[model samples]
Target chain A: MKYAATDLDHFSESTLHTIPLIEAKHLNLSFGKQQVLENVSLNIHPKEIVTLIGPNGAGKSTLLKILLGLLTPDSGKVVRKRHLNVGFMPQKIQIDPTLPMTVERFLQLGLKIQKRGFFRREYSTTNLEKYVDELNIGYLLKQPIQQVSGGEMQRILLARALLREPDLLVLDEPVQGVDLQGQTELYQYLNQLRHREGYGILMVSHDLHIVMKHTDEVLCLNRHMCCSGHPHSVSQSKEFQDLFGEHTEAIAVYEHHHDEATCDHSHGHNHIHLDETGESKHND
Target chain B: MIEMTQFLVFALLGGIGLALISAPLGVFMVWQRQSYFGATLAHSALLGISLGLLLQTDLTITVIVVSMVIAWGIFTLSHSKQLSSDTLLGILAHSSLALGLVLISLQNSVQIDIMGYLFGDILSITKTDLWLIAFTGVLILLFYWRHWRDLLNITLNPQLAQVEGTAVKTVQLQYILLLAFMIALSMKIVGILLITSLLIIPPAAARRISDTPEKMLLISMLIGLLSVLGGLFASYHFDLPPGASIVLAATAFFAILQLKKAPM
Candidate 1:
């Protein structure tokens, strides 16, 4: 098997890592007579981030619901590894103004509800603080969940998902309401988390630049899978352009470096390489 | 004196126990803004009454079965997405009440006490009714105690709950069934029209003072107990209907809480 070996490719050359952590086989879901998703199949491997992109009314939410087991597919099967755990960060959730919930309580609700038996013990608060600190959400812990800004809420939600220590992190619009700077930091943090924890991240996003730059695989869907593969390949495919329009073609790949300060310290001021068409390869 | 004490004790215990169990259920109702949903279920209790009279079986059990069926119907129909939940509940609530009235009117032989069902005569609560309320109360409290986190999670956002490995369908069905049972059992205490008030007002008022969900539930239970006590007292002294008095007392508590300066 001749594999494409390039310095630019970040995919580890490990043939043994073939089994996917999660698999959906030929999923078909319909609402009454109108079919939403048709014969869709997708897979997620350990330490891989796969992004699903589609236009409005294109069954994106339906597909996400199916994957989360919230909606049943008409004629398809989803297989997860035995005892496979998933942490899901949903799209923008609006809490009723009447039900006052602190961010700390909101995060705790996710961990506290994990039904545990005699064998498994729940995570303690002190242990969860580690994730809170890592996500830089410690400041908002005491604040009301409803009062937190959109970016802060996103981080809090991420922190809550991290508490589950899931095998796969499924995020639907993880940075929807955040600005450009916050979005980049979140994506960078996610990339580093995947590398460090060997997690399989599945995210649904409309940000072409971020998905093109960071994701290992991109699946373009318009009811059916139009085109899917490497982000570069998908963006170039005629089917993808047909579904997404030609404007996506000009989105230059934005790559970031940590500089001497490193993300370990507070300041993450970095440089971006606008690789037009991404034909240039990075060494080391 | 001892005989009087025993009678009063049973009534007091039944009312208070029902109030405690209602707290957990009520909190979810308020949080999810499903008071109307509860009202719809409560209204169908009148239908359950007619069905019970028609079946000539255990009235409480028949009521439970009918309410469960209606609750399940509302649940399943809402999933169809053809009609909004409010529209469905509106149709079901009023139509079921109207149907129940028609069914009762058809039975010329049965001189049904319709006012008793509409406005609850708690003084007539049987020993069997007391025991049923106590048993169901214990079951509900246990369900809420063990599944406290699950219930709250589902109420917070069911989609997130599903992702966290909660069996959303099973939990939801259990919740709906329990809600049906509550309405069926409490029909004797607060009647049909006022059942939702007990489920909503206490918790809604509790939100003003509570900073956490658990605290809210506890405070709601306390508030409900107070209302029951005050209502029973008023019924005894003023010869007022016990169900209406209880709901009125609850409304008073709500008004008082609103009047108090809430910590912003």
Candidate 2:
């Protein structure tokens, strides 16, 4: 299904080596008097996951929508690779109460593209069973989508998005309603998925603490690109500190702890307690 | 006496056909909460009616065109940042109805039954009207047969459907155009005032019992058909207005079904 790129000469050699999944340059969008997005430029390449982090009203959603071509930008350009397939998992889709849709039926709605002919033939993709098992939504498959919990719904949405076998996975605040533990598991699962499939993932997230662990890069935005780099660099940068304030200094960018077996080089664990006169209690 | 019987048969046939035509569209109206949109179309139909009478054109076709034009116009105008959809629908519904009444009052030559236009008269349904119902009924069935999945997907989520390459705008425009047609044609069956009820109630009732989308469609059609029949029978027996009788029958189904719990 890969079509040869005809405009390969237009890009630089570095870009020619591997085409980016999505490239947006200086995108600007506004609604009447309110400027929502300004001079936003970013790129998502395959086999990488980039996380978008911004405060409320920072136009993260607007930028994501623009990249997906749902909303028109005032002035800019977004070039998606030819025949690029995007599996979008929205924050939440409100289905009307009148429409009766079970989880299985909800997922089946995603199958319209693969369905052929008048008979439909019950089309099934190879990843359907695999993702269903991976996400552990087998029990929730038959239940009404409205009845499922928020965590379960996120997993189901992820499962449905995975079924598309997308070249790029676009998620908008995917773990909004899920609890703490569930969020960690979801991000872990996403990391595994990205590593296995080599799909480019562009996700919008609000949780700064947990997401930075698995995220390769974080683009901090506020109606424009403030700063963007790898987790450690972005977290330590003055732009991030100014935007988030001093409280962010304590936040670890990634899980600093590793199993003893994984890291053979062990540093000495020493703690000295300060008593009334001097450091009295010492442990090594 | 035979003429009276033939007229009654025409009325029954027309009622059944119109019910079948309007039922599926009604399901969408209920699901999308566009009952007021139906009412707006029905109200504006008075302008269509007045225009048809003044111009010596086919009333049904004139009404359909007029409603479609109005629907398109409203869609275009609502894009403006000035007014909200609720306000626009309200203004259009009342102003069009008022203007229509004024226009009809100016026409001195042809005698018009305003009550019949409002509440409907089953006995007055002509053979041509019956044929239009048959034509529209079959057309609706063909449309449902060809584009049911696309229409359902669009109704569920237009943006999602569009991303899936479902031709959302075309399906939506077609659905709205067909809805305008139904509102125009169903005028003779349930009259302008009761058209929305006929379009909404049976489907809402069907929603109570149905598990799947296909089942919902079937049950809606059946309920609508039964309402027409039961209404015709009650109108004949109790000498009530046929359209009102039909609506009451549908409401009875809603009430009766309300007693039975929705299945797990």
Count of backbone clashes, every candidate in sequence: 0, 0
Candidate 2 chain A weakest ten by summed lDDT: A265-274
The list of candidate 1 runs beyond 4 A from truth reads A1-12, A112-115, A118-121, A124-127, A254-284, B1-10, B79-81, B261-264
Q: Which ten residues in a row have the lowest lDDT in candidate 1 chain A?
A: A1-10
Provide DockQ values for all models, in the order shown. Answer: 0.54, 0.44
Q: Give iRMSD, candidate 1.
A: 2.9
State the weakest 10-residue window (summed lDDT) of model 1 chain B.
B188-197
> Per-residue error at B229 for model 1, in Å?
1.7
What C-alpha lDDT does candidate 1 achieve relative to the native structure? 0.77
Best by DockQ: 1
Candidate 1 per-residue C-alpha lDDT over A138-180 given as tens digits, one digit per residue, 9 for 90 to 100: 8888777778888888888888888888888999978787866
Q: List the residue pairs that clash in candidate 1.
A: none
Q: Which stretches in model 2 have alpha-carbon errors above 4 Å?
A: A1-16, A115-122, A255-284, B77-84, B108-111
TM-score per candidate, chains pooled = 0.88, 0.88
CAPRI accuracy category, model 2:
acceptable
State the lDDT of candidate 1 residue by residue for B18-133, as single tens digits: 78888888888888888899888888888988988887877888888899999999999987678988899999999999999999888889998888877776666668877788
